[model samples]
Target: MRGSEWVPGVQAAASYEARWLPKDVMAGLVLTTLLVPQGMAYAELAGLPAITGLYTSILCLVAYAIFGPSKVLVLGPDSALGPMIAAVVVPIVLADGDPGKAVALASVLALLVGLFMTVAAVAKLGFVADLLSHPTQLGYINGLAVTIFIGQLPKLFGFSVEGEGLFADVKGFVTGLGDTVPAALAIGGGGLAVILVLQRFLPKVPGILVAVVGAIGAVTLLSLDDVDVVGPLPQGFPPFTIPIVTLGELGMLAAAAVGITLVSVTDTISTASTFAARAGQEVRGNQEMAGIGAANLAAGLFQGFPVSTSGSRTAVAAASGAKTQVTGLVGAVAITLMLVLVPGLLKDMPQPMLAAVVIAASIGLLDIPGMVRLWKQRRIEFALATAAFFGVAVLGVLPGIAVAVALSVLNVFRRAWWPYRTVLAKPAGVDGYHDVAQYPDGAHIGGLVIFRFDAPLIFANARTFREEIRRLAQAGPKWIVIAAEPITDVDTTAADMLEELDEELNAKGISLVFAELKHPVKEKIDRYELTRTIDPAHFYPSLDDAVAAYGQRERDSA
Candidate 1:
């Protein structure tokens, strides 16, 4: 029972209600319908055999059921990860053109990613999931969506395009346009239309499942020999086996694993947070990381690849009234039964139909509305998002992730480097001093400057602070009183600058005072002995107190 804190599924089972059993069973069956086609589709998308997707789905679901904290979050192979996986494994396998080697490399990559995620969870590093900022993440995903849609174009039209990056893929698609098979195009186009229409109008119907069934039926009835079918799947459940790779390949796979783990953790945490809020459950972030790690590890061990939380699948399960992890377990069992008893069930399913499934999923991944909102609200953030998008479109998927992360980090530094600084003035009928830019008619006392610097006094912006103060000093004010409420920190470089600036000002018959400086920053000032050079009496607890003191000093002098 004590260990149940770590193993949440055990706790859930202990408190299981009888009424939930039927709901879980039904939801699991419904979930399986959507899972089968998607699993096969995403597997092909990842440059692996379609059957491996089922193995990944089964293993990840079962493992997540045991270790996952969220009751409704679903773990599986994802459309977003497909290209990333292919980017890593395809180049390596291109030399030998062995499907077996590709699978092994991908599995090893999954194992490494799982290990990294598990270690991070233990270290309580769940906050690292925010590696991708919202704007940059939006751009990267949009770029990825476009790349995937183009990559799948040749497949959707019944030909194969072999190229890297967006431009090359587009060119290959164009060059191979003459080889397009009409039957494949019609079936694939019709399948995509069916899914889009059903999903748009009839939300409850499993559109992917319907499209798959219809395509298979059409192929079988019409004897469509021009189309490419999935053929028979390997029989039985995935066997437990350790994926191995050479020492030379280990480093490259590990690098890919880091990117995969980052994306997986981000996706899982966000998905879990959304579903948990709807379910009225708290998000245990660290526990969720462990759950994701366990699922990936399990999949990697069983001839499968890395996976993440699937928002679409979870939505389906929740809509169907899933009550517990039992739903996921049920889905896993059903997939296992299908593999063992009906291995050739989807043998007649057309490859173009699979492309349609992936293309539809890719379309969903785009956030056009979100991109438009970013552009309208904040142009700088829109630029960041656009840069991230181009990073993926111009460079490869892996490099694009690098670009997004770099841009996010640089954006943070950019803010801190030149944060907003303004002059504050007390306006008529206002409670306190406000930005003078917003109150041009605000009153101002002679020989007093109420300046505000809206950032920490770090080394990055110390020069900027010095220049702003010097610029204000040229007006010949007797005192410059900083509205310090927003100045959260006073580093050593800033303290030194303050001492020098105060001395320089005093030499010019002007003084510097601080009001509403936070206690922590004051403590740092004292630690740096800044008060020895600058007067301690100049420090005031609030803006009002500083103004009163200034007025009193002037009256006494008069």
Candidate 2:
């Protein structure tokens, strides 16, 4: 393997330009501002201590810089993964109520995810990222946004509410409404407004950093003793450790890990593609998987949880003039210094402010415009998205992911089982033959019927194809010419059906023929011994050729 394929950072460092240092350093310093608050908030969201988020941020940023292909992409604790982590860890930890156990389980989960992704990268299985289709992904994210927003409501209001799922959380929040703290509410609500307003109007500004700093100041100055704070963090860096769990628990963790890997891989690939396009670089998908896996593995070894690419943080870095991975290296160093020198720096930071950070991220995940666009363009895809949305929002995160994958597969099958079948006719002044249903006024040849089936001919659709051909035969045309361009592949069952159908039609003084059949599919027909009943001479390279041959035969007879 090429050195750049495995360790892209070394290649980048070897070719490092001196002029990029200042910009990278400045961007790194600016990124630190947003990273601190977001890391802590996402850690809490994952049902781990706030400090673990910092550990995750430091480790992932450093590790990705070494192994990642993208120069400016940032990796850290993500808002979307919070509920997924909590879903897996909370139930297992609640019984013991040991924070240590919770951290260990989360670390192990991270290890499993890292292992899965790394192996997939080695096997070049990056296409598994397509397991979640676009429409379903949009719905799943929308549902997750609702789940995260609802889950944080109690914390945002400066209280604790416990429930199992979305509805339970909603009920818990409503029941605990009177327990709201005014000071926490002010800080959370105000911070949310400030971040949203700045993001909308002044996107280049570090709005999250501003909100976090402002909240810290308000809490310290106003002496808001009533508001809950994160308290002082543990000092220094996390020591390398192996997270262990029971064998029985391993099965459950593995299941959740697979789901998390899917989400993480999808998120990373999409984000990498976007930034790579902007920078005029190619997306090395397998390398990207390896990079993400390395980051997760490093974090898991250091008592940190799973991490994914942060589009918002990457955008912040880019907007701040990031030119290389050195930017992330700088951010990691800054975070490590803060952990080592002053763990108490954010002791006065209000918990509500953290809630606001998460809520704002959740709001960004909504994608209502995409939903509306899908509905306008394709109702079937819109339905798939809706199913996926309800799967995540109503059923739960893990189950919702399952629903999303199932829906994508089933949708593909639905199209194959009953594909669009149409007849073609030559319209006036048109270059090619068009669908008869669409061009009803077009003229059809007296003795020829042109049929089109818009899907691959496979076992699932073989019967459907045969039935459609029979129906078209009712027109009593002397020749039936199939526009076979859309039929990209013909499976064994479909080839067999074609042989039988051609024999049946030939018995009725009619001939069956294929026009514009792909070379690959034609090879399959010959290999399947379909030439015995269906004449090889009946196949034409083009529809016009087939029609002209029929006219020539008629003229010869006259």
Candidate 3:
């Protein structure tokens, strides 16, 4: 068995060297600085108590270090998953009126998500992550950023707004602006400004840590009473427990679990693939699914919620020269030490400052430049992205995700439903056949037409293919050669259509020929008896050979 197969963690540890220790230690320290604030921030974002973020962060890091395939991936409470968790958990908590029950429900949700991911890994269904295309993903995230930003605005101003959904939150925020506490607004605004400036001018500086510490100090020294703070946290390591929920709520929890699983796996694979590429390493998507599943499972059992790979945290580790999963291990240990030793250190930390942390992270999530590039390069994809953006921003997170997924599936069918087809001709100075639409000056051999269809022959597009072929035949060519290199598959419906087209052509004194047909596709056609109906001799190895044969047949007829 391979080292990774025998023991996943051993692959990183076995190659460890003393020289890499210092960088890993430093990276670990840096990661802890970010993890501490972001964890609590995202936890509250998920409608849980702030301390759960630390629990989620610590457990996920340690779990991922052991089972995760990537050397540098950082697993924790992510801003992207925050609202999603809140959307599912908060409603149940409000209905039950029990905080403990809410935590259990969140844990159950995480456990379900982990199990789904594990099943996907076992089934090698990593390709499901590609259900959302690049543009759709971009738009969904941008929409998420907007959603998160709007949700956090009232918190930043030290006011509570009770509302459901994105628009309702927006409405609450707008009306609640009058109730904002000046101290909270100042701290949140100042912290956000400092983070942005430091990131812009001195990126190597631990800007978030600096901003968080500064806010804490200001709140303490100023004795700020009006500002909302994180208050005191329970000081200890996370205890293990199995989540219990009523059987009646299982169906609702399962739906939420599926949503979380979809987003988490897709986010983890994309982040891992990117960092793995930068490190000149390959990413095992299925393994990543299992690793993230293991991490979420550990978190759920430890009184934490579902977690996913954090691209920002992973980037921090990579930039700080992390060498292995030891970075994550060290970071987890550091957070544990803080929880045990300095649980009250952030007691005066303003809640708005935490809100600022989330806002800063959300800002990074909006890929405006990427959206612009998409708009300029591919207009239709841009439209798809726009649709997803509106779907999330207007419809709410869960509904938006459903809309994005539907759009992705529809985009696939839309392309196949009316795929590109063209006539092929040899340009005077070119050696091979080119699309006549693109090369209008190209020559078409007399009494023959070379046609090309640019997609697999599937049930969806079978009729369209037949119609196009019929239209082309109306030109009354004695021979029609299909440039079949692009037709990768011929399904049962398509094969049947081809057989019918062949017979019709033969009855009209025309021969249907296939050129550049792939072996598998030809085999499929032969299995359907198309070869017998159309004559096996009519197949040619290349478009040029088919053209030569057409020339010989014309000479013989003359």
Task: Tell me the alpha-carbon RMSD of every candidate.
Answer: 1.2, 1.2, 1.4
Question: Considering TM-score, where higher is better, how would the candidates rank from best to worst?
Answer: 1, 2, 3
Candidate with the larger lDDT of 1 and 3: 1
Give candidate 2 misplaced runs (Cα > 4 Å).
none
In candidate 2 the C-alpha lDDT for residue 323 amounts to 98
* Cα lDDT computed for each candidate against the true fold: 0.92, 0.93, 0.90
Count clashing residue pairs in model 3.
Answer: 0
How does each model score on TM-score? Answer: 0.98, 0.98, 0.97
Model 1 scores a C-alpha lDDT of 0.92
Superposed by TM-score, candidate 1 places the C-alpha of residue 310 at a distance from the truth, in angstroms, of: 1.0
Please rank every candidate by lDDT, starting with the best. 2, 1, 3
- Worst lDDT run of 10 residues, candidate 1, spans 1-10
TM-score of candidate 3 to 2 decimals = 0.97
Per-residue alpha-carbon lDDT of candidate 3 for residues 138-250, written as tens digits (9 for 90 to 100): 89999999999999999999998998877988999999999999999999999999999999899899899999999999998899988889899999999999988888788
Name the candidate, 2 or 3, with the larger TM-score value: 2
Clashing residue pairs found in predicted model 1: none
The superposed Cα distance between candidate 1 and the true structure at residue 315, in angstroms, equals 0.8
Please give, for residues 133-236, the per-residue lDDT of candidate 1 as tens digits. Answer: 99999999999999999999999999997788999999999999999999999999999999999999999998988999999999999999999999999999
Error of 1 at 317 (Å): 0.8
Spell out the clash pairs found in candidate 2.
Answer: none
